[model samples]
Target chain A: MMGLLETAKISLRSLWANKMRSGLAILGVIIGVGAVIAMIAVGRGASLQIESHISSMGSNILIIVPGTTTSGGVRMGAGTQQSLSLDDAIAIEEECSAVSHVSPELSGVAQVVYGNRNWSTGVIGTTEGMMDVHNWSVSSGRFLTDQDVRSSTKVAVIGETVAYELFGSANPVGEIIRIKKVPFQVVGVLAPKGQSAFGSDQDDVIFVPVTTAQKRLFGTPFPRMVRRISVKARDAESIYLAQEQITALLRQRHRIGPNQDDDFTVRNLTQAMEAAQQSTQAMTLLLGAIASVSLLVGGIGIMNIMLVSVTERTREIGIRMAVGARPRDIRLQFLIEAFLLSVIGGIAGIALGALLSQTLVLLFDWSTSISPSSILLAFGFSGFVGVFFGFYPAYKASLMDPIEALRYE
Target chain B: MALIEAEGVRKVYRMDGVTVEALKGVTFSINEGEFVAIMGPSGSGKSTLMHILGCLDVPTSGRYLLGGVDVGSLSRDGLAGIRNSKIGFVFQGFNLLQRMSALENVELPMLYGGVPSRERAEKALAALKTVGLEERKGHRPNQLSGGQQQRVAIARALVNDPPLILADEPTGNLDTKTSVEVMELLVSLNEEHGKTIVLVTHEPDIASFSKRIIRVLDGSISSDEVVIKHDGIA
Candidate 1:
């Protein structure tokens, strides 16, 4: 081992003697590793961003929407067939084993007015459980109490976007807003939720009590009301169970026979989240595989240069062997030199990759995250490439006949 | 007992499908503390014979014994071990690693022998001092004059404290005065340090410095003669 170190020292000195060639050789590895890391990092960042957007929607929540039936291989929404009702929501909440909370939501587009400000936005009527189901929090004042629902009070909670548009720097609490010509006092303002992955403005909707919006605002009857019903399971693991129970309860409540096609669709947020995550994972794996091609090219470059180096340093190898160096020592010397080149390149590539990814995040306002395991994997892969690519040349060097090598011009 | 013994040694080279014999049934022996020179013209196989004696090449058919071990029967690593611990080499071209300083060049053999760094440093300095090159130890081969580079090579050869020192035309690249100086150093090393010396050269004046001269011609030893034995310079 010590002899190998001495040989490596001499080899490094030789490499340093020709600085331009050495630098160019290292540059090849650097570019290869750098390109690989940057490509994978960007791909991974984009995939994770997509995944988190989906995950932020909600974990245990499920949405039941009106379904579309196919005719002649063309699918069309079968309209509301009176399959879902407020009683179905109540029954699922009361009877289902996995159901944690359920809320019936009625939505419509309406012009909201506060003082001299008027903005057209989405208006929703729901119970207090809707806030908890969506994991929403009130930034100011309080949400509508059960007494407000029972009394059908004309009080409302405005979303942050509506509050910002109407009130600006003024607090919207206790302020009266007109929705469809009916005056309602703002009881709370929702915290900002930015935008969803589907480009929906989550904080652009105002909430009012279901009974007040159904009877007084929209004039829709209690049984023939609501656009969709949202349900939340106890946890992520209970989402499938909650979905099954809700479907069964709604089917029974509607008096639909077992042979008839269901009129409603149950969509679990956990399934959407899982789908998003799986696609991201697949994208990451694909990007990683593509990056490995560049690593292979880098390995080939190392092998080509090492072969040239062996030929160029034939006389040096002869001299070392003549001076008492063993064959293994000579081989190890070249291997170490190649390994050092690759490891150095790997570290530099990782740094450059991280810097570039962070710069993308800062400059473009993109979401990015780099895992520590990926860095370790990149480094380990480069070292392994070094060994794999360096072996043949080193072996060739060690196998040279000392006499013939000394005689080489 | 002789430190090196060669009996019925032969080396054949196959070049372009033709067999060319480099050494033919050469027999010779050298005892401890002996300074011998082999003289011949180009293509006389003196270099081939030197390579064989230094364990750099194996004879096709023969027996070579160094310190009672049959070197011809040993494996390549065994031969390398002998080269590392028993024989030191100096070359005509001064074969110092061009990138290494004189001190590092001198430390080469001991490094191969797995000597500790501190001890290798001490011995390398001492060997350089033996060649009167202690002050120039930090100079690289390209930085030093041809004669100085040769001296560094000699220091490297002696650093292992090997029993045998083999020089192949050691002064071939040096001027006449430098050649005499290098010859005097070799004579002194053989006399004062009791190192067995086997040098291959074509110069008759250089051959006279050794106590014995062997002449090779046509792949065979033509003559073996003992010359005047003067007390070597200390």
Candidate 2:
């Protein structure tokens, strides 16, 4: 057997002799690898964006809603029964071991009028703890205090979108907005939270104290009671434990027996986020599988061209063998040539793939995160393609009858 | 012992489902330091004999020996080892690898034989100098004339210092004047270095330059003659 260095030298010489053919053959691998990397990158980026949006809803959050016991044996979203109450939120906060904080919220669509301008926006009613639970910060004035909520004050905080629509060039703070013909002072304006992944306008909302909303605005006792309860756990690891504790407590509070469904549903934001993440992982794998087909196509391309090359270089092979090149040496030469082509194409493809992903981020304003492992995977895959595709042609070349090849003309 | 010996050698080839015998019951022997030539018409199978003698092809039936070792039973790798260590080949087409410079081409056999790079370079240069191609050693085959390319090929054949040099119509591609010059160089190598030379040619003039000539007709040697020339040696 010849040394690897010597084999490489001969392989390089052969490639150099047929420079254009070698370049064209490697181009297939380059495009295939590049496309694979770019597709996975885009998929990963979109998935991450979804995950972030889910996370922005707040980690450790357990949204509690009423559940339905269907007579027809079908379970559906939230429940038809009004089993969830503000007292449950207070109880969970004071009783659950894993609970960090809890806030109940009531939301509705309402038309708000500021001076002569009127717009329809989401209006949420909740306790002051909602701000800290949702990570909402006030851009102007102050958030509603516990005193404001307890006194049933007719006060409100407008989101950035509402403020923009009602008082375009002026601050909306200290202005009065009419909700359902009930006047409320806008004590603060929220900072922009941008658009959510679902294209919901996060900034287009108004917040009010639940007591004031139930007593003055809607005028019904516990009117449109808390649709969902938000909860926060101490850390990421405590999320599952917190969910279990909350589930057991709510089940007991509702007198839920074994084998019977609870009257309310408690969901953690982290669970939703994990589900979204798993879905993205599936998408990434699917994209990678699709890209793997291109690699096969690229491998086939290398094999086809290498077969042609072997036929073309028949005389050269004969001459080398006659000059004392062993059969294995000839095989090594062709294999090394094919391998080098793929490795070079792989590197070029990686660079092109990175550039492509970055271009998507820059031009389309998409978020893309390229993992180092992907780069290694792509490169290693291309090298494997080289070896896999190169084998047949090299074997054919080595197996040629030297006398017949010499006489091949 | 003779440097090369062949007894009752035969080679058969199949073409398009028809078997043709290229060599039939051939027998020959050559001592060390002998310069011999084989001459035949196109279909007379001299080239086939040359290929078999050079270990490039295995004979269907033969008792062949090189340097006193039986070669007929040698495996492919054994044959390759013999080719690398004991025999040197030169072809009519001056089959130098076009991408390689003269020195690189000359160094090929030694490289294949596992010689160190520095020694290969040194010996390749010396061989080129012997063939009066040292100055053109850096030129690729395409950059050199037909005669110069053949000289480089000869230099390559000599680089390993093998005991036997086999030239199959080495001057067939050269002009008349260049052919004489190449022939003269071969004669000098035979006389000065005592290298055993076996040349194949169809031209009578080319065969006349050798000290001994064997003529093949109908796949068998018809005549074996020696030629005496005076005042041709310088």
Candidate 3:
């Protein structure tokens, strides 16, 4: 058998001699690997964006919604019973060791009118601590103060989308907007936070003092009742403990018996975020699988071209045989040719795929991230494709009868 | 023992349930450093006999010994080793790899023989010089004339310095003038290098360049005789 380097040298010479044919043969592999890498990159980027958005929504958050209630034998869904109160949020903040901060929330949908523009958006009423609990910050004016809630001031903070819709590009601070025919002064405009993983417009809500909402806008008979309570844990590791402590406290405060279910439920945002993360990971793998089909097609293309190459070089094989090359030597030469084609094609594909990913980021403003492991896997697969696909053709070349191959025109 | 000894050598081809006998009980021997030519018309089984002698194909039934080793007993790889180290082959078409330069073509047999690159290069250059085409070593087959291509093929065959050189119509593709030149090169290699050569051709003038002629007709040898030589043996 010839030395591996010698065989490789011969193979490279032949491939260089027929540059056009070699390029055509490798093109399929290039496109196939390029598409696979790009698709994986985009999918990974999207998933990472989702995870970051979920965490940015608020770290270690637990939402407490009122449980179902029965009135006259008809059951009402969660958040309909009005079983939570401001005192419950205060007690949880002070009594639960795992709990760091708490805010009782009262929310409703209202149409706000400023001059001629009218836009429908969510209206949330909460205390001064709601901003810190939700990790929100005001861009222009100050957030609602403790004095504002104590005095029942009719001042509100607007989100970026609401500010844009009502005031265009003009600043909305100190402007008066009527919510449900009740005039209120805008105290601040929240900065843009983009979209949530659940496809909700996050920057389209308005914030007001909890006291002002109950007295001026809602005028509800239940004075201390609120929609839900939002709580924050000291850190991510304390979220589950915070949920358990709050559940026990609420259950005890509501005076529910051992056999009876509590009137409020605690929901762990971390668990929900983990579920969303799992789904996005599945989606990334699915996209990767779909892209890999093209690589298999590329392998078949290699096999087809190698078979043709072997047949085309039948006379050359005969000459090598006549000059005392063993069967394995002939096979190794062609196999090395195919292997080089794939490996070279793979390298070009990685470059092209990165460029394509950058193009996506530039053209459509979509995030694209190429991981090192993906590149390594794609490169390794290309080499395996070369060997697997090149085998039959090289074997056929080795098996040729020198007598017949020499006579072939 | 002679360099090559064959007794009761026969080859049968099975094609579509029909058997064709190409060589039937042929017996011949040639001493070391002898120049012999096998002459026959087409379909006289001369090529088949050459194939068997070169170890390119195994006979169906035979007792053939090359360099005192039984050719029929060696494995496939062993036969390859023997062919690589003991014999050199030249063909009618001057079967040089067209994509490689003449130097590379000449280096191929040595490459298969596992000769190191430095030695292979030196010996390839020396073989090209022996064939008097060392100046054209960098030219590809298409760039060279038919005669030069044949000379490159001869250099490729001589790079290993094998004891036996097999030439099957070495000048078949050349003109009369080129053919005479190629025949003279073979004669000089045989006389000056003491290399045993087996030439296969139908041309009487080409056969005259060798010391002995073996003529085959109907798959059997009809004549074996030494040519009267003006130029004596080396």
Clashing pairs in 3: none
Q: Provide fnat values for all models in the order shown.
A: 0.64, 0.48, 0.70
How many pairs in model 2 have backbone atoms within 3 A of each other, for residues 3 or more apart or on separate chains, i.e. clashes? 4
* Cα error, candidate 3, residue A293 (Å): 1.1
Native-to-model Cα distance after best TM-score fit, residue A158 in candidate 2, in Å: 11
Name the docking class for model 2.
medium
**Top lDDT model:** 3
| lDDT: worst 10-residue window of model 1 chain B | B225-234
- Candidates' chain B TM-scores in the order shown: 0.96, 0.96, 0.96
| Tens digits of per-residue lDDT for model 3, A1-409 | 6889888888898888889988988888898889889989998898788778765677788999999988889997887777888889889988999988888898889999999999999998898778778888989998999899889899999999999999999989999999999999999998778788677999999999988888877765589778989998998889888988998999999998999988888988867787777887887788778877887788888888889899999999998888888889889999999999888888998888899999999999999899999999889999999998999999999999888889999
Top candidate by DockQ: 1
TM-score (C-alpha) between model 3 and the true structure: 0.80
**Candidate 1: Cα lDDT at A21:** 67
| lDDT on C-alpha atoms for all candidate structures | 0.84, 0.85, 0.89
If the candidates were sorted by their lDDT against the true structure, best first, what order would they fall in?
A: 3, 2, 1
Rate residue A392 of model 3 by lDDT.
Answer: 91
DockQ of 2: 0.50
Model 2 scores a TM of 0.79
TM-score on B-chain, cand. 2 = 0.96
Any residue pairs clashing in model 2, and if so which? Answer: A66-A79, A67-A79, A67-A263, A68-A79
